[model samples]
Target chain A: MALVGNLRDLKLPNLIQLNCMERNSAKLTIEHAGKYGMIYFHEGQVVHAEFDPDIGEKALFRLLGLPEGKFKVENGVRAPMSTISTHWNNLLLEGLHQLDTMHASGEGKDRRLLEMFMSVKGVRRAAIITREGEIKKGDFQDDKEFALQALSFYEAEKISGLLKKEKSQFITLVTQSKRIILTEYDKDIIYLDIEAKYQLETILPFIEQVLI
Target chain B: MINRWLKEITDIAGVEGVLLVSDNGHIIEKIGTQLDQGTLEQIARRILRIITAHNLDEKSVKEIELICYNYRILAMSAKTFTIITFCGSIRALSLLRITVNVVVGHLIEDKKSMKQIGKYTGQPEIVLEKEYLDQLEIKLISKLQ
Candidate 1:
């Protein structure tokens, strides 16, 4: 749906456009009616996003879960004002359920799971990637690729560890201006790696929450 | 063997020193060059106090692998032991990761050594004035370090 009002009249779109134009690194919290979404902007690019219920990587995957090839961004020049309210909330709840499972399994502290949690929390839009040779949204079209690309190398490693019935030795998630990497090591010390380019601002808060 | 492992870890991360600490902030074994045993002990004590005051459960504290700013302090845990690494601010993430990984592996494999070290160096077992403990707890939870 066309954003119901002029870009200037919509607080979210205006803030997003302004931030995108200035290349600011900050978190934007947007609420419409009772639904809420947060978009993190880094260097004027929309790198990470979330809505009322979902906050980090889970948010991105949920967006990926949208029918393959059916995913389309209408009015790429202007943000959608239709408020994907139900979709966003559903994703948030789903993300929370996943988090609860991880926490209960004694795996909440796993860096990869934590990164996924951060990427999905409060997110509603696809990440904007500007890095060269970096995999972004197209990877989300395939579930496996999406999982590998969206998580850090450390997270992939953790998954591999679980797959092999090995104890996870270590997990690490590192984000720079251009990329997010997750790495996991098995108790026997094999490594798994994943990488993607998105804005760091959107992901930092989630990381902080997980770490702190 | 402990010295050899510490040397390997320092080589990996450019770590200045490493220490084994109890959850209560007692120092067990410390190794490396140009070490600040006193200051490091104080920092470890402060970290424990901070962890306790914040009411951070075991799960929450285990998630913090590294804390970096002006200087870098890396925390890794295995059951009852916490391994703390001190490094210069300029250390790279990869280097830090390798160092933490090697030390953590070695620590896990050498639990007996850690316990023996703990026995010899026996934590200072300080008894803080009640008011001092309260003030420190307040400062720890409220301030960012």
Candidate 2:
């Protein structure tokens, strides 16, 4: 039988641990946003893994950064070749270590982007999401991790050409709960956090003023 | 250590190649897809210029990623070496970040790499300064006295 679930509830470590304890030959497929990776277990030991074009420990460390994603394990699936040799415990520890380091310094804040968000009203949370897959938050107050992921999946990758061709400034998201605004800010998307009630027009002038 | 880092970083899905460059335009090491020494020097010069331009901004020179239509470049600076990777296409940020941090960790944590960094920095430079000339002149005068 195959076991599958979201990464939010079952972290990668637990998933790996459970599979290891079961002593099963399996292939664990991890999905985050739209990207996917596979980890192969031979008799409860992680013998090989891949998130191509990454393989082995490099892929493992890269996959560990997905704070939220999905994972499924297929029993009896085998690895084509072994690419990892370290103990699972040591690998997990090292992967987590790399993840923490990347999180701390990967995305850097641009003051102008922060100032633009601060000058606007009803802005709950904001991040300068880059084309290179980084989120530099405007403030420390709100956790917009989910919103950031959705925005990154859609706006950061697909509409990049659209924004540039038209020279458009930003896009607004109005949902039942909140409003998120996106704009071009120095080769990155400005994911502006706004209250649900506030109209897009209300923040337009402030955005134009500060961004200019 | 540099060889191991190059090997690991190239293992990333879209990473095509990596070059460890010294500040004064030396290719300390190159792995994966090969680039001519001229092209490598050009890139190294540009990286040096950009880092120097943004030198004042706190942490501005730490990491620089340039995305283009065909390929991408990601560069991170250590104490003496700048690690640059050529990517097939830009993907999620985490992959690049992980690769960068891991390479930087190797650049710092490895005893051999640290020693190599010192050796790399010890290369001769032609830069001359008035202060150094004055100091040399004074020493000469003292010897004459």
Candidate 3:
């Protein structure tokens, strides 16, 4: 039989620690917002992970960041492949540390950054959104469309991992309805709506300034 | 001839690889020997799906530049094909954009390339499944004491 529960009730780190201390080989699968992530433990050590468009350590970090989800743990289920070699203790610590950093820098900082984005000349609107497309703050009339545009960052983040590149600085898209500029700030996606008359390049410096 | 056009983009500094994928996710042409064919195909398919999921295709998004810390992925769309580039340390993106424009122009006008693209016009795209996770579960269950 498998252990199944919600992440809201039991945080992932606690679950990871529980499995590790028990020295059980298990597979913990998490489903959030229609996406699935898996972590495989072999004798108390994390051996593998799989998240859509990500595997190995990258997948582990992403899984760790999930705030809420449904999780299942099947005991004695060995990993098909081992994509991680870090000790469980170290892995857990690192994952938790990254989460802490994101939250610490995220909350109060987003509003200031959004205001800075709006200050840029030729900027029509600015919004800050979570990775799951939730609008944390924005003034856009069509919030749904705005959130959808920000979702484009997920592909960039995935591709960057595949290419072994650094974190993305910004993404610019020229779509039919709007000219958009997007950046990752404190784990939140900050996007801007630009006027048709303003050249994107000319507006980049301001965006860069706010990022700095 | 298509590979030759793609090579122009790969030849640029910081560019690791380039793939010209059809609308339905077929790799019409590619350059950069460092990345394997399977990896390139998967990347192409993933990007195409993302484009469709976000309705970027319907929005007529002409150009997209995903600028990362140490690398970049640039995609330029023509009506029939999209050029996806994996680049490292992009120091001259303007030059790369120009090169892509020229190459895409050539592809649009090239009769042979257009004919090849037409073959894949109505083909269904490959969708990914998560059967590996389930298979692992079954294998482990069978091994239970």
Could you say which candidate leads in lDDT? 3
lDDT of 2 at A100: 62
TM-score of 2: 0.37
Better of 1 and 2 by lDDT: 2
Which tens-of-lDDT digit does each residue in A1-212 have in candidate 2?
Answer: 78989888989888887888888789999864334689999888888887745789987776666555678999999899999988887888888876666556634236434533543556666676654335555555322333333332332233234213333345443333555566666666676767666765566666665565
Q: Pick the candidate with the highest DockQ.
A: 3
How does model 1 score on DockQ?
0.02
Clashes of each: 32, 4, 0
- The local distance difference test score of model 1 is 0.43
lDDT of 3 by residue, B1-145 (tens): 8888888999999899888888767887777748778767766765665455344324566778887756677888877688998888788878999999999999899999889877776433332223321342223222221
Pitting candidate 1 against candidate 2, the one with the higher DockQ is 1
Candidate 1: regions farther than 4 A off: A1-202, A205-212, B33-35, B51-60, B63-70, B118-145
Our model 3 lands, by Cα RMSD against the true structure, at 21.4
**TM-score of each model, in listed order:** 0.41, 0.37, 0.60
Q: Could you give the fnat of all candidates in order? A: 0.00, 0.00, 0.58
For model 3, what fraction of the real interface contacts is kept?
0.58
TM-score ranking, best first: 3, 1, 2
Task: Report clash pairs, candidate 3.
Answer: none
Q: Which runs in model 2 stand beyond 4 Å of their true positions?
A: A1-212, B56-60, B122-145
Q: Which candidate tops TM-score?
A: 3
On the 0 to 100 scale, the lDDT of residue B43 in model 3 is 67
Q: What is the TM-score of chain B alone in each candidate?
A: 0.66, 0.75, 0.77
Considering chain A alone, report the TM-score of candidate 1 relative to the true chain A: 0.25
- At residue B11, give the lDDT of candidate 2: 83
